[model samples]
Target: MSNQKIYQYLMAFGHFCSDINQTALTALLPFLIAIHHYDYTTAAMLVLVANMVSSVVQPLFGHLADKFNWVWIVPVGLLLAGGGIAATGYTSDFWQLCLAVMISGIGIAMFHPQAAKLVNLASGLHNRGTALSIFAFGGSTGAAMGPILITASIALFGVQGTLTFLLIELLACLMIGRYYRALTELNGGSIKAKQANAQATQQDQWGAFSVLCVVMFGRSIIYYGLNTFLALYWINVLGTTETVGNTMLSIYYTIGAICTLFGGKLADKFGARNVLKCGFAVLFPSIALLAMTGNELFASALLLPMGAAIHIVYSPTVVLGQQYLPNRIGFASGITLGLAISIGGITAPILGKIADIYGLTTALYSVALVPLVGAFLLAKPKD
Candidate 1:
């Protein structure tokens, strides 16, 4: 309805499009392994490459956005992201597919810091948590949809059917491109507001921020560990169909989206520190339960809380990171949203290697141990 709303939604949609490709690569791994006869390590390496590139490079993009307004990155980033997904099925070479996925990762990296900054600019103080949640909710939804999209596309026209989602990305780009002028104007006011806000929060608490980063690192191990291996665990361990395997993955992400959206409001009410503490409390038993169970019903039940616990901290951490280093807002976002998330992906290969040697359940159960470490990191927020 309003200009800011439109811009926020546009940025959110850009996040959706960019992230869909990242998760799609994960969903496609079983199929890739089947067709290429690749080992678990090799299949997971694709996730590693895409995530590694996006994670390592996101802070660079964040600095650029901080120094200069880069609204154009939204549409351009979406195009690169979608184009990479479209090209995936076209390539047979292992290295070529890796390159394509890495292109998608770069697009992901390009979109996030700028989009995050845009959302912050558009939302202002009253609804900061809600706005970040909405932005991240879109991404969680994109990840939820990835398995379904990839599965259907491959089923319909083989792997090349990844082309199916290109039109949607194009539409999103056109919508954003049409209003870049308005977005630029929006940021003019936003920058002034942010500067004032940043000045007010100059009581920087680097010690707490460092602890928070550790908290994020632990969560990533649990979150990405499951994501990288969930589908295969279902298919290989539980002997489910590809559809069934993907449905399980989708369920976790879909629930994750809901929890993250609500988690922000919860964090606002409870304080981010308390919210994170509760989330870590749930993380241990829920994930351990999910890992140990063989029955689909029990697994699904555990997944709901595990998903909720992991994501409940998502928006809170971002908000906290920004609060912790208010003056270096861009770097805070880069480390919190981008680099913290990337940490999980970076370890996906290691998790895959663990799954290779120790079995998927063992690898994932190892993740359950991480939340205890996160719980220990929780402390009183520096008001």
Candidate 2:
């Protein structure tokens, strides 16, 4: 295969591996608590620690990717991450489980930044948005697949069967290692060596980049709230069955993936700004409609367009961040992809607290207003 094809395949595989474990890992915690008689709060806390560690540590790896060869980091991280998660099946105590999860999070942290930066490098200005969108779509598909796969595995062989799932990730990692040279060529040569040839450094625009970072931070807060809590809201507030609720979440992610794929192509054909604006414009009414409705079918139907509208903006905005810091594509992807998502993970508890006090409906209603603010803040980037 050509370098570009190999690069795209590696990226898709890496993203798929990173994401498929997320929902499965979290779902495993609840299963442990309910089925194995562990502490609920402890199980929940494991999820928090894993997410926080994964998000915060990704940027450090991104920085390393920028300064070091880092090609070898991806497969190593995947192996460690897969092994850690698989080992969770054998842990009998809470601390053991936490340690296992922390190990997996470390592996995740090591992998994402390097992979994302690699994605950005392989994509040129003309097709950057499309390339990034395809990469993100792969991850979204994996994320959606996680719950279903894990739930099925658990149903058939209990939680211990999760170990078998690790084989998929292991094969992917080996594939990435096998194609390393082609990936390097596709990513515009060695990450550390080639970056010095670019124009001005990213540090030059501290002021504007800071503002953009805040916008990403805000966007993530709303995004994770929806991602993490949607199922709970459906079951607890709207009185849907857990199975039905999970399927809705799956549909949301599936639509998000589909939209991102097209969104990239559109951004390449039109302008990234045009695609971004259109996505946000659609999101406003979608969220409003979601807040006002309670019907199960209606809510499920709303997720399709709502997810599409919300995520279609992702690739374009990521490209915008890189454009703003044209010389520091690695750092830009880290900030937007890694740190922003981390910030969102931090805000999840606050959203949960609000839901506890006010109501899930009210919490979601409030979340609807956040994206509008992001849309407004994002306008200044164009100016």
Best by TM-score: 1
Tens digit of lDDT per residue, candidate 1, span 130-241?
8888888888888888888899899999989988767668988888878888787665554457555555656777888899888888887777888888888888888898
User: 1-383, model 2: which lDDT tens digit per residue?
Assistant: 65664586578778778777765675464467567675433444566666688777777777777677667777877776776778778868778887887777777677766787787766664677778887878777877777677667777887787786578778987788787876665454654345445544434455666766776776676676676667776777689866666667777878887887887788778766677667766766777787788887788888987888777777776677777766666777777777766567666666666766787777787777776755444433322
Candidate 2's C-alpha runs over 4 A off are: 26-33, 36-44, 92-95, 184-204, 379-383
Candidates in order have lDDT scores of 0.81, 0.70
Q: What is the lDDT of candidate 2?
A: 0.70
Per-model RMSD to reference: 1.9, 3.2
TM-score of each: 0.94, 0.87
Report the alpha-carbon TM-score of model 2 versus the true structure: 0.87
- The best candidate by lDDT is 1
**Worst-scoring 10-residue span by lDDT in model 2:** 374-383
